[model samples]
Target: MAQVSLRRLVKKYEGDVQAVKGIDLEIADHEFVVLVGPSGCGKSTTLRMIAGLEDITDGEIAIGGVVVNDIPPRDRDIAMVFQNYALYPHMTVFENMAFGLTLRRFPKDEIRRRVDNAARILDIGELLDRKPKALSGGQRQRVAMGRAIVRDPKVFLFDEPLSNLDAKLRVQMRTEIKKVHQTVKTTTVYVTHDQVEAMTLADRVVVMNNGIIEQVGPPQELYHNPTTKFVAGFIGSPAMNFIPARLENGAGALRLHLPEGIVLPVPPERTKRYAPHAGQEVLFGLRPEHLTEEKPTDKANIATFQVRPEVIEPMGMETLVHFWLQGTEVSARLDPAVPAEVGRPLTLAADMNRMHLIDPRTERVL
Candidate 1:
């Protein structure tokens, strides 16, 4: 296992189109770092650069403390797993997994030992004799991974390896991959557009936007303490709600004045940090989970408000209540036991401690 470092990495295409802006990242040995962003956000391009599949327009890449700016991909000591399971149909799983070793002319005993060990780790030993066409999608993916594992390369690069699987299969494979990482502890760099995958698997998630790094942190850190509005809005399911509002100093205390005469007091603990922005038009950011049906609890900073739900969706464990505050739509999560009806006023509690204030002009979370 080896650490990888990218120093001021840059990638530009024809017409001076910059796919990846100059960015610096240091990945520790045996760490799983995920590059996550929307389409055209340069995550894939960055991964290809690290894999030596794409030429760098500027800066340098180092693996195991050696600069690989001009190193051929074959000599980079890296293995890549792509979205499509590129397996040979005519070759059995064993043969496919052992192909790389065979080409390198390893001893026959060593090849068999490595292939058997990888198959056991992947739990696909029984399917080793079967051809690619006879295996399931997940099984074929395992074979591809086994092929990489048998090489024992310095780094592992995965480019949306789970994108081709069904949702249920994707979840299963995710666990499998995590298990493999735990067992092998190979330094890994994964690129995917799915935030869920990034949150679940990454030791650190790199959130990219417009070819720039917006934020990089552990999953929970980015979720609860996003420094930028883009990170706050992009890291959660159903997305965090951003409502145009003004932070007013009401009687020496700061309060958020939202649309439709909805006013929420800023928690006492946050007043000091947000005082300078008082009376400024800022975005009120809150996640759906933070807004829920009024419940009895000892939790501090709880505030309640009334709103007539416009749309109610019944998920199995919880119900989602959506309402319109002036022209802006807001959603809240409630218990399934509560009978929430459209056009009926329902009291919901907001955990003020979890709320965020974002500057409208710079889009920074204050």
Candidate 2:
């Protein structure tokens, strides 16, 4: 219903702690944009500013093309679901969902109609008469969502709403939230430190770090073609494997020197990016999925390595192999059906076409 835009937004504390450093983002109408990062990375601050919950130290914030930097939180017409649920303990599910409208002095019939509709849509109609104390954790979360839905705000903001639930319930609610968004098509901005949730729920993901916006893109694009080291490491589960390698040769075809007789033969077409850094130290990044146990069938570009296996974990369909490479610990995804032995030396093959080259000096992709 509303498109939110942040132009050079900034927030600074009294103690000179820069909470959010000049971040600019545009979230379109009906788009589910997720702000994700590590702890104290300014993601929540940015969300608060958009919701009018925090004062913007500098820059412009526009909602539906209207500048609302000076507006109050309630006047912003945004509904927020918090991590704590924040349900009234003594109130029944119906009252909890109707509280906002009642406070605004909406007619009794109108409040009832909205509450009933939200409850039905959330599949909590059966529990409408139950109190929060009598509901399970997942049920209470649904109640919280229903309460927000009843408000009928132009924009929906979720501030780590799934963090309070168990892992299984979190996954369930993640799906439910996505379904609800699809039904309502209200513009939404979600904030979380959980990469899995960010990747799964968002239409576009904004990766933040150290009070700055590191990268923003589709989940798969950010995962496969990260623009920086922080993004490459932060956006994926188990993180991307970073190994220090030196470019050993010149322009035509750059060859990277790796430990233990391992060499990465870069394709001629991709050598242009590494042309300036030939013979310089660079970081090689490869996601766990890009490294496989299977032999390379595509001879176009392949990099081989030797890893001393430290841990073997079977995740049903895939096995996770953790090992040490060049004094750094790294993990790889492999076929679970393949027999893995602990403490055994394993040969890992990487699809060089999918490999990433990052500059250590700038931490940016080459």
The lDDT leader among the candidates is 1
Please give, for residues 176-275, the per-residue lDDT of candidate 2 as tens digits: 9999999888999999999999999999999999999999999998998899999999888888989888886654678877665678887677777778
**Candidate 1: segments with Cα more than 4 A from true spot:** none
Worst 10 contiguous positions by lDDT, candidate 2? 294-303
lDDT (C-alpha) at residue 168 in model 1: 100
lDDT of 1 by residue, 1-366 (tens): 899999999999999999999989999999999999999999999999989999999989999999999998888889888899889888999999988888889999999999999999999999999999999999989998999999999999999999999999999999999999999999999999899999999999999998889999999999999999999989998899898999999887889888888889999889999999887999999999999999999999898989999999999899999998988899999999999999988999999999999998899998
Best by TM-score: 1
Error of 1 at 320 (Å): 1.0
